[model samples]
Target: MIEDRYSTASTLYPYCRVSDQDAEPRRHPVVIVGAGPVGLALALDLGQRGTPTLVLDDHEGPGAGSKAICFAKRTLDIAHRLGAAKKMVEKGVVWNVGRVFYGGEQLFEFNLLPESGHRHPAFINLQQPYFEQYLIECIRVEQSKGTPIEIRGRNQVTALTDKGDFVALEVDTPEGTYKIEAEFVVACDGARSPTRDMMGLSFDGRVFEDNFLIADVRMEAELPTERWFWFHPTFAPNVQSTLLHKQPDDIWRIDFQLGWDIDRDKELDPSRICSRVDALLSSQTGDVPDYELHWTSIYTFQCRRMQEFRKGRIFFAGDSAHQVSPFGARGANSGVQDAENLAWKLDLVLKGLAPSALLDSYSSERTFGADENILNSSRATDFMTPKSKAATIFRDAALDLARDHAFARTIINSGRLSVPCVYDGHAHFVQDALTNGPEVTRPGAPCPDAPVEGGFLLDNLKGNFTVLAIGFDCSKLKLIDGVAVDVLCIHKPSEYLQERYLGGGKSAVYLIRPDQHVVGRWPEFSEDKIRAALLTALGKEPI
Candidate 1:
């Protein structure tokens, strides 16, 4: 039997009344507007840091349908930091290879992770509901250990006022209404954000005219666990494109591009949907396979984002801050990264360790990420749904050449699958001193994971602010900018660690941020340079 994990009938967090609902407006260090993946992840980060945080959600539990099925490696790494990757990784369908086809001809197949030493696979396919469920469960466990995290279900934020120093919020509940205040408000509400509407803000970008028929089917079939994207498939000539993905359990996700002028109601009919699925199956197995429809929906996407993610005391993350086509699996993956980036900065600002200006970097850095996702998603959408005659001709020509030439294979854009955005040039940019080091671990780039003697390199750099020494000794430096830093000195580095961190040099030092991004790197240990980099990262002056 197929289970609907996204159904609204499930009440993971039941309605509950607290002192804040009955008394004067209660204040918190941080208040999250939505309890989706982004909000829950942000709460996990802040709460684990001992920050008083609360989450407000209109629904009782996970939403209906398996919305996002692709979770990237960087996302898993962030989840590992928040203590919620085990269940997700275990329950998800892990895959690293992908095959692209053009109308009965195989163009090429590629593996996202060709090298070893990484802790997680390239990507995993898990329903969005399961993703949220694991996070919510982690929150419950953290609460047991005295993490000041509170989640109120059926509580909707109706209005909010930014008072400069803080923000006042009005929330409606099943019973009545109440008011609350917070030093910071994070909007993780989905694309049609009520918080954005309340703030009188909107996205600025292009909205393509195309519809996708998404069907989640439950059936027993023998199919390889890999991503299969087809352009101009032979099975259904009427369909422009098709995507097949393996989700957890026996369910499979299939997406059909129905173009701009599609009959929504007629296409959603069970017979019509079944026929489409049967056609796809007949091509693969030469027979119609029996299957049950677990869920079905039609979606239209837009590639857009706010000019700025932060405005006053209220901040935005996830879909509320940006919206991109679902072609690249960038929507949820990028949102999780946004939560990670904002959580650390907010922690520092609320604790008075760094200037409030540090928060500005969050906007600048994430907008950089949002723009990358938008450009890639827009390009993928255009490639899939050609608008001009020249575009179609070019795409077809590239596909024809892909059957023989490898260069043409690179030209086909079937959703450049999500990868960690290497923020090489963005605000709070720090110059790199280890010029000979691997470019993959340069400043503003996510730390590459490598196997070490103890476990993994990422596991060793365990702190909001970490000073990682690969081959030199730096036990004397403990704190930077008056904040404690997790200084990890490894003199006897393994080959993997030396290759990733030190590159061709004998030794190197790196200052990494709370989100595990390298703030700066040097060939030798220098206290003054590290201090200056830390200050620069925090948007403050060097001592």
Candidate 2:
């Protein structure tokens, strides 16, 4: 087993007792519980805005295993903004093609990176430990740059009390227990969140009876760095489905679907796992490659989420707020987006620039996102593991038809891989009344990335409210106070940009939020209308 390969020492944060003469319960602007990807990303996002953030995690360092392998384009964009994407991309494996097979017959394949003009690719595969380690490094760099982000490892929040304006917390550390208070508390702790339990919140959704065996194997083999999925492959008997994803360090993530009534212990035995791996590899290549087990985990799929993400002064992000099956890679990516969504709103609220009501938009928008992920994940799970004979018949028929017809291939749901959620009907988004711009750049959608002068459009719109003017003058527009608007004038539009954005005409203006979601767009620039849209996007005005 590859146990020591990913071990790292934790960085300690000085703790002071509440009873100490000089040490009163230290009050922070924001206290984030759980220093995983979501919490760390939130800290980086807030820190970039010069917001003071404290992140506490019970673990001494990053967790072991390649828990989340696929990082999506939207997540890489967020990571790029946080100053960690370059490292992640450098240390990860990038793949865009996924091939599906049904009982040794290649059904069809799809490409995720069919378009250009975007900086990052469709997806990159890296171990979760590496992901977390890079985020921790980013946080430290931000702290050194005077961002005031403190990450305390091995510090667990044992108790929490919401006191209206602020949330009080009791933290347990190696030294002793201490108390602290924060204007806001973000729970990024995983599914079985202590913070969620402490708040008496419950998640509601379906937990699939099917169990999956996730095995991480390191081998010196010449397998393509693409996703390979199988339905009833001849390698393993009684196995309904299998998924294989290649990660960095020659580690391959293999998932096998084990039906409901499985002996958990027997299934996880090393010998049994090795035998299954040997059979799978032999079936694929007609020869078994030398390999060694790294990590193994057995998990049941769950598509669940709390009714509301925000509860009084505390907010839940990531898996704590919602969870879905790993099939779509929605769990981590959605969590990262959740952090991005909340960080900007929380920063504004902390700086007294926006009301607490602005935070409500986070709950509403992410709840919408979580619901969409749940629906897609549940459907994929249902297709992968049919509960009834009729469902199985339909699934097999679709697979059979996929091999012959292109139209039938669209119905095949190996997993409708996660895509960014567009907050289409969100209260904060102001729809464009003008029919000049492309529908792809409609309000509430993630600003369609396009090539601009010297770099991409999204690179220029980072970290602030952006007023993007394409073939138009927006110099006369005035924005609300405290809202920093970066006016990006695209003098010469690329073909991709023209097609995806300036469709009807070249003259268009887009008002984008800090999170890069389009708030409003217009054919002609209007200072009054742009200002009103900004206010609406920030929850300061009614749509």
lDDT of 2 by residue, 167-216 (tens): 88988776777789999999999898989988788888898989999999
Candidate 2 clashing pairs? Answer: none
Instruction: State model 2's lDDT.
Output: 0.86
List the pairs of residues colliding in candidate 1: 6-63, 6-64
- Candidate 1 Cα deviation (angstroms), residue 332: 0.5
What tens digits encode model 1's per-residue C-alpha lDDT throughout 1-543? Answer: 112223573578888878888899988899999899999999999999888899998878888775788899899989988889999999999887789988987789987764588888877899998999999999999999899999998888989999989999999887788899999999998888989999999788888988999999998888887788999889878788999888998898999998999889999999999989999988998897778999999999898999999999999999999999998899999999999999989998999998999898889889999999999999999999998999999999999998899999899998887887888866565798997898888998999898877788888665568888887678677777677788888888888888888888998999998899999999888888888888888888877
Q: Give residue 530's lDDT in candidate 1 (0 to 100).
A: 87
Error of 1 at 450 (Å): 0.6
- Specify the poorest-scoring 10-residue window by lDDT in model 1: 1-10
